[model samples]
Target: MNKCVGTTEAASLLGISSRRLRQLLEKGRVRGAYKTGKFWIIPLFNHLPQITKGTRGPKGKWRTSRPPALAKINVNRNHIGSNIKKSPKDRKPVISVKRKGTNLYGNEVEILGPCKIVYQPDNPLDCGARLWIDLRSRYANETFSDIHFIGGSFPATR
Candidate 1:
């Protein structure tokens, strides 16, 4: 007659947890395992039972069909700026600085005048570069690379 053992001893011999062995018995994965009353009787076999890998739950409907296509968006690059316009209340007030002192390069610097603050999303240096390029293009005869800021009390915009 073959020897039999409880779940605990059987799990120890099989190098698995008692709960896992109980689950295996419940799922009929273990060949010689049976439930007697509240306890389980597992036959002591020389080799461990082979448990094949399979999907955990019921098959998904997604496997049989393709996913829905996303809606396509048409965006015009030039008009993108128009959509990002902020109301006058939400805008940052322009900073006004009086030009007086010479910069480190010894070039006389001056604030041309207060201008509307230009919004540049990602890189702040790009905004400065864009302004410099604009100034260079506008006043082709004048040099603007040495323009520097001088200290002054700026009045807040009402």
Candidate 2:
């Protein structure tokens, strides 16, 4: 199907921000779009033009890499330096867990522990982040989709 759409509509169809689409149009990057009467009309059924070299206009104004005045920020890395550190006489292996998201009942949920961020695909949409805890926990790698709500048989997990 062949169709011409306005800038914002084309951007929505392309899954990109409208301003970024306009920037592409202004830079002559969008393949099947043209400026007509001060408006860029984009053709449907065409791939969004790639951002090429020099498409971005003049460089942003120069600024210091760091703020002029700042306090010392302490970033704690827990498990990263495990090999280098000396251990106590005897200590238990602490199980650290981080969690997010509310139960099916719409209550707020939280978890406290050391933090390590990793990217994973198949994450659920239409909700907060999915939580992955120790394998033994009842809610390991649980998201809203995993909650079984058949006939209200089971109480919500908090």
Candidate 3:
């Protein structure tokens, strides 16, 4: 099992596409690698029978908890998910906002002409919710610099 093969040879030996082979190697699923200046080398462990596709590990895709937080970065301000404006003949401009739980990193923001409030949830509960506006242009030096509550209050927790 000490055969050293190129990426192409490794792909052919596994009867899989080169992309897939590379993925397996990167993920540590296969027992081979491309040394700094040598071909892909297969270790003795690789001689074992291949694991059939679709086999689940102990957790089986269901996570008991959420992922970790991202590296701290500057705040963003500009595209704030502010209230929508609506024009009326007998009434003032209507404003609508919402607050809800989200599945991704941050809350989901949606705004219509101006009617009702919209809410979205955040992924990691520890980081709490935040109002991020893309401040890449107007504030050339500042990447992010705005924070508002779902209820439009400072230090507001939803």
Candidate 4:
């Protein structure tokens, strides 16, 4: 039941900008903000900056989950996903499969395990679906690493 804004309205209400809210208020991380004279007095937080759990998107590897066996670090011959060029037995590293997609909270998902594939490529929108195995069942974790579909003949369980 409290509020307090300034410093560019608390960095535009936490959308973050005003010089990153003055570097999070000089690294004090706002909280109750202070510093008068030149103004800073910020303290409006209806929830915005906590975002933990692997720190999602922008290369933090999103929720992680992707590198279970990107071809076990490619033992030698390369090529997998997009940029097609298959060799090492038609390359395959990039696991986690459970089908029926839509995760990250959009719900309607149906993969009881694994799911991590990504090869985005859309010239105005290709449609082969370019890989993108998908995960997010809370970062699905059954100890992962199926060794590229275990002893071959895949079938971890439909």
What is candidate 3's CA lDDT for residue 117? 20
For model 2, residues 14-57, the per-residue Cα lDDT tens digits are: 56688877877887766677888998877654323333345356
**Tens-digit per-residue lDDT, 45-77, candidate 1:** 432333333348653211122222111111123
66-91: candidate 3 lDDT, tens digit per residue: 22221122222222323223233222
Would you estimate the TM-scores of all the predictions? Answer: 0.31, 0.30, 0.26, 0.18
Question: What do the candidate models score in CA lDDT, each in turn?
Answer: 0.42, 0.42, 0.34, 0.40
Candidate 2, which segments miss by more than 4 Å at Cα?
46-158
Best by TM-score: 1
TM-score of 4: 0.18
The candidate with the higher TM-score, 2 or 3, is 2
Model 4 misplaced regions, further than 4 Å: 1-120, 123-130, 137-148, 152-158
Best by lDDT: 1
Query: Candidate 4 residues 1-158, lDDT tens each?
Result: 55566777455444557885676577675566778988777654442222222233353111112223222111111222331665655444333333223112111223334566455565211333443444422232322333223343332322
Q: Rank by TM-score, highest first.
A: 1, 2, 3, 4
